[model samples]
Target: MFFKIFIFLLFFIQSSYAHELRPAIANLNIYEEDNITNATLSIRLNLEAIIAEVDINHSNTKESKQSDKYESLRNMSAVELLEKFNSKIKNLQNKIYLISTNSNYNLVLLNIDIPGVGNTNVARDTIVDFDIQNIKDEDLKFFWDKNLGSIILRVNSPNNEDLYSKLIATGKKSDWFNPKNKKEVDFFDNIRSYTHLGFKHIIPKGLDHILFVLALFLLTPKIKPLLLQVSIFTLAHTITLFLGVLNLIKIPSVIVEPIIALSICFIAIENLFTENIKKTRPYIIFIFGLLHGLGFAGILNEIGISDGLFISSLISFNVGVELGQISVIFLSYVFIALLFQKRLWYRNKVTRPLSLIIASIGLYWFIQRLFF
Candidate 1:
């Protein structure tokens, strides 16, 4: 009824545990000494996440076969973790890609900061510093392999003033910035970039979000009802996505994720029971959308949008999300629902069975996200 990859990811979640994959945040600062320019890159990351080699595409760490090794590293003392990191030093640097217009600069580890094994309950935030020289004064470009996951790169001036920041998408090389000249990205380009980000999130990346949208469609096969629900869900999430990113209404992912799973469970279960659209369904969905928006915010927050691009970025991202949800509905209707919705047994045979599977998946996610 749903995507095969969705089914695959469901099994992934089933075997996985509590750790979620988070982006590594890196800040690059430029320093000038006697007319020469050098830069220091400080990255705050979950070293264990990289050391244990979690699958980059999946959202949860437990999805990886090496998750056991990841957990073991997570439980290690600061010194122990450093030893693990040292073992992978050469291979790890090969994973990082940084270049200028003229040449590739090597990343030399200056030092590192690792926390003492404090809360084995949470992923430890390890910060590492590296030095890269700039002799030719060429603009710098950054690239991240999927294996390294996503990166939130911020550029700073020697005076400590913010120069530029971006959530560099995977495998995509960033615009050449710094080295006394930052690349100018026009408004339309920003829209395209953010929109792609939003679409990517819903289509392949956001399994939980995809389930919610599909559940909405299974409830009412008609275009009108589905559109109404989708529109309301879109608007509600847009409001909270902006608010969540701006830090006006911040809700931790820990609380938001479980509730999001619960919302999907509610919708899928409702599909199994209700024949006609409920008047109150939209209202309930509106509230759920708000919570989902907060979950959406976690991505942008990690990415760190610039003040100037905040409005454009948020609107573009929401538009992309809408496009993504619409794509799901459109494909389902064209392929599956269209041929079957008119049948007398459609609701009983198609809708109920699919809804049951979806409901079960949601329930599992809820319990896993909550207490696991």
Candidate 2:
């Protein structure tokens, strides 16, 4: 019964993890002028093609209600009400973007001069909006009057509504071919009203990401294999991250996420039975990491940062993520590696169980993500 339960758990995990992981892309662009930083912002999901889904239920309900004799025409139409609400929601969530630092904020009311859309320069006016809630500093006057060239936009949340409000401009990050100049671009970087500390989304807090990496490294416990897999994953993620951000390649979250979860479960299961990683492990990891990285990028994409200073920001953010991942690996090794040294049966009992557990958790995530 114990063995049977373990097997059942294994299948459950595989199924769940397979559907939970979504793929996204993060990209940053920095624009500079006259040595002083003019705009340094990061843009995420600038090129996401949100395929509109027709609401059949809504249509059917509206038709049925119209045919009802008892219902008054004056009565609030559910379909009409839904349509109005959805429209407002869609407008707010068109291209969600977040401004990172809202402290001592300079809410510039920018009338962007898109080359084709408007008259002249993109950063023409310098009228800043005022929000007293975020102003904690005594010297708030500096942000109000000074023409400080530096503008940093960062994403705090990655929800649909947030994306529509914060993300200023929309286009492929890599669309250098049709250089519409800065004026024709979308989101303009002007600081907003919010908290002082740097803000980011909560997606990184997911346990599946950790388990995926853990499962990948548990088998060999050797530096070489670990390094190879890590390197491949990093490289693959980088490629897709860039591509996804630029809108060069767009993969829907619904499809990409579940697959990533499945990948985690599969790796853990393989570790349970297979002793050798085989030479192709690195290659496979790279491919999957590419998908996973895109998902990570999605958070950043929702937040808009200036085109200037994007390089430094991107490098720093990527490094920060890497450091976080490495810290997890170190802690796990310290906690589990020493145990393996003491007992040979540790491989069969502890390692396998741990792998199974990881796989099970991943499976659960997959199911919840897909069905829910």
**Most lDDT-accurate candidate:** 1
Cα deviation at 185, candidate 2, in Å, is 19
How far residue 55's Cα lies from its native spot in candidate 2, in Å, is 36
lDDT of 2 by residue, 16-128 (tens): 33212222222222223453222222222101011122121221112232323212211324344334334433342333232233432233222211112121111111111
Error of 2 at 43 (Å): 17
Candidates in order, TM-scores: namely 0.80, 0.51
Cα TM-score of candidate 1: 0.80
Q: Please give the RMSD of candidate 2 to the true structure.
A: 15.1
For candidate 1, write residues 1-372 as lDDT tens digits.
Answer: 455645865676454423666678888888897888888888998899888887877777776788789889989998998998998878877777778767888899999899987655457899989888754566778876777887888887788766677777666677778656544557788898789888878876677898899899999888788889998998899899989988999777889999999998999999988977799999999999999999888887777766667799888988888889888888889987879988998988788878877888899888877886
Candidate 1 contains a number of clashing pairs equal to 0
Full-model lDDT for every candidate = 0.82, 0.46
Tell me the lDDT of model 1 at 29.
Answer: 84
- Model 2 scores worst on lDDT over the 10 consecutive residues at 140-149
Model 1 misplaced regions, further than 4 Å:
1-9, 13-24, 31-38, 44-81, 94-106, 111-126, 132-138, 144-150, 158-161, 167-172, 179-183
